[model samples]
Target: MALVELPYNQLVQWVIARGKTPEDCNKRLIAVEELCKGFFEKHTSIPQDVKDMQRHVHCEYTEWYEILCDITERLKSTEDGKKVNFIGQYSYEPLYDADKILRAFRKNNLHIVSYSQVLQKQMTFNLPFIKKGIESNNKELSDYKARRAESLRKLNANINELQNRLKVYCMDIKDYPFNEDFEVCLKTRLTQEIAIKNANMTIHNYHRTLKLVEALDNEVVPVFKAFVKYQKMDKNYHPEETMKHIRQAVKHGLEYATNGNEDTEERPSDDANAEPEEEPLIQIVKDDNELLVAEDKRRIIFSTQLGQSSFRQLLLGELLELLSFVKVRIDELQNRSNAANYIFSQSGENVNELIMQPISKYEKYIEVINEVIEILSGTDSMKALSILKNRSDLEKSAQGEISIWKRCCKEVAEQSDLDKRIQVTTETLKRFTSDLESARKTIKDTKAKLEKATAEVMGSPVKIFGEIDNI
Candidate 1:
């Protein structure tokens, strides 16, 4: 029986088996079926009415049949044709209009064709080259997928391990936070927060990188492959041909490549009606460089602390509150020293000021805390943080756990990963202090104006917009 006479499904299976891997056989079969159905539907003249087709009176069917058969044979054939074992001994014979397959070969040298108009001037097609190119893309895509999966596995493992460690840490400290229902001290809380936040940030970075990788594999790469398939069909089909027009009509199609599914088919063009001067099919090699660049970009984003701004902001807020609490403690100590000095004076003895140095140090920290808040609220928290690191006290603290709270605060502030947050904190404080100074000036000016208005209005006794002392 002639190839055209074969059932559509059987023909698709035959074509797919010729060149496609068994893994993708089912997927390609579905694609071929959709392509064929779409082609037949559009070229109703070729298939004719069912009754007319059944009557075997129309010659259009023959042309259409030949085109389909040619496409199938081209898809299945190797560059240098060779006999291969199937269920039985079979050979791929180039069907009529085999020259149309040149389009497929043209796709392999897309970059060249795009660069050189001279090459595209000639109607040249190399089938074997196209086949090799497709195989190469498949292999690379496969390899990338493997690597991506491995990366995801490792990232997930790290995240899980960190989570487990955090869980254990929490359990260990759960009872250590207090004795006899006493409130947890800031040092203990700060210590736990610092450790937890560090782990959480690492996990966040891994998750973010993993997501980008998934996007490349699952979204970008598939789209790239679909474009290749479309180009393969584009060469043979003329943009003006009924089948091509039909395919293009449904360019945003429900079935086939239009659906944006990996399993969907590529769009087909009609070679017979295609313009001779039209550009040849070109394939864009899915660059491994693109993937590598994306990975590098991901690393940069996480490295600079830009990727998790929201989380860092929350942490800064916590630090600000803790610093405020520290300031209050300093104030209390200062008040106690003042009281002690007064008592010593009453006893006719002098006492050196205690806690004055610590109080002064904490006052400077309060200023830093204010600057950090200001930086976080600004447009460029990262830059602010980076610049603010110069004035940071986190790294200036004396080494060693002199006190539980001091150690925790020092560790948290000095942590390399948290340096960005400290910087942001200081910057925020600077901004807030500036705003506060400006507001103070504004308030002073307003008070002076109010007093002046009161004087002028009382002298006039009938002016509007002035506060009356009685009211």
Candidate 2:
């Protein structure tokens, strides 16, 4: 359901019905009412936010970081060359260079949150209320894939495909081959005058015949019938091509040996006391066109993941300015509230009116967000990549903080309710005690009256009995 603006009364009732006391409810009422009224609907890209960044960059703070310095330098550059084009008198922002760098990453599948998407996020968080739930609604495919892990079969398939691709990439790009070590011994021809050795691989003087022994390091390397290594001693030799062959051969040697034309079926154990056989690992290559894409996911996971973090950090930096503004405004309101409370306290009138105030925070609405992405730049892709790596941990921390906050609110409400119940119980006990005392006093007075009446009758009764005896 769409979240329309709820009235103050509705918010009050909503809070109160959830075990919150009226005083506590009033404290929360303002925030929820404002939310329902679209007070926070304005995106961080407002002119005020821009101005605040301008002001912050202009000021010289001792604690300014390296990234902040670069950003401020960009801002200061605005004063020098604020021109987009000579024909058009377009101006540059202090963050103009940074903005240019940010745009360069558009081809990256990173989400650049616009001012409008910020509003959409509000609705996105309400996904639990959506019709499709989480199976598939509007979440990006990349986001879904990033969060979920591949199944064992899929992962094995991917590993197999990657191994094959490496072999293909090496052999196809250059004349690099599956290089291996060969245990070779010289076969010498004992002639009458001169002795000659056979050429195993390297071309040598008086060496012609080449013979191959069993493949050396067969356990570690694939059991190839023959292996080739090309090495040019001339100035035309390329070290990069040579290194690629070496790296690929070493990395995928075991993989090729395990899967390349080997019997994969498990062998039956003949001896019971023999060492337990390990579970055989089999890899299946699937025909998936998705892997045919030009984008390299491995590179993205390691190095090319700047776009998302840059977008995130940029949005965060913008929001910090807005948060700083809100913090100041809230502080002013709090000071005013304190002054009003002090005035009320000075009045000596004895009254039992409840005067509970909600806990006043001087800093941020969500404190967890304050520590996120302090000062990120588009230039440092490494830093951005690092931020992307810790996405899961950051998510956990935020969710945990939110969960703790919800628990704390619920506890506060419960405590308030408990105090109220205890007070009512104490009052009932006092009234019962007072009534018991009054009843006791009345019982004592009636007993004294009965005693007096009995005594007076006794005093008269003695004479009556004497008169009867005389009669």
Of the candidates shown, which would achieve the greatest lDDT relative to the real structure?
Answer: 1
**TM-score of each model, in listed order:** 0.16, 0.19
10 residues in a row with least lDDT, candidate 2 = 187-196
Worst 10 residues of 1 by lDDT: 114-123
What lDDT does each candidate get?
0.34, 0.29
lDDT of 2 by residue, 301-330 (tens): 222212233333434443355345435435
For candidate 1, report its TM-score.
0.16
Regions of candidate 1 where Cα sits further than 4 Å from its true position = 1-298, 303-306, 338-356, 382-471
Model 1 per-residue lDDT at 154: 53
Angstrom error at residue 128, model 1? 91
Model 1, 1-471: lDDT tens digits are 111222211322333344322434334334443444444344343212221333322321121222444454543454333453575333433321133333332223221112121111111222223334445545554554555455455545544443454354343333333232322343333333333333233334333333333332332222223323444654663323312211221231222222222233432233312222322112111233111112322233333222345434543554454455556546565777676334323221211222223566556555654554444454444432322122222112211111332333333334433445445545555555554454344334433343333233224321112121111
Tell me which residue pairs clash in candidate 2: 74-94, 75-94
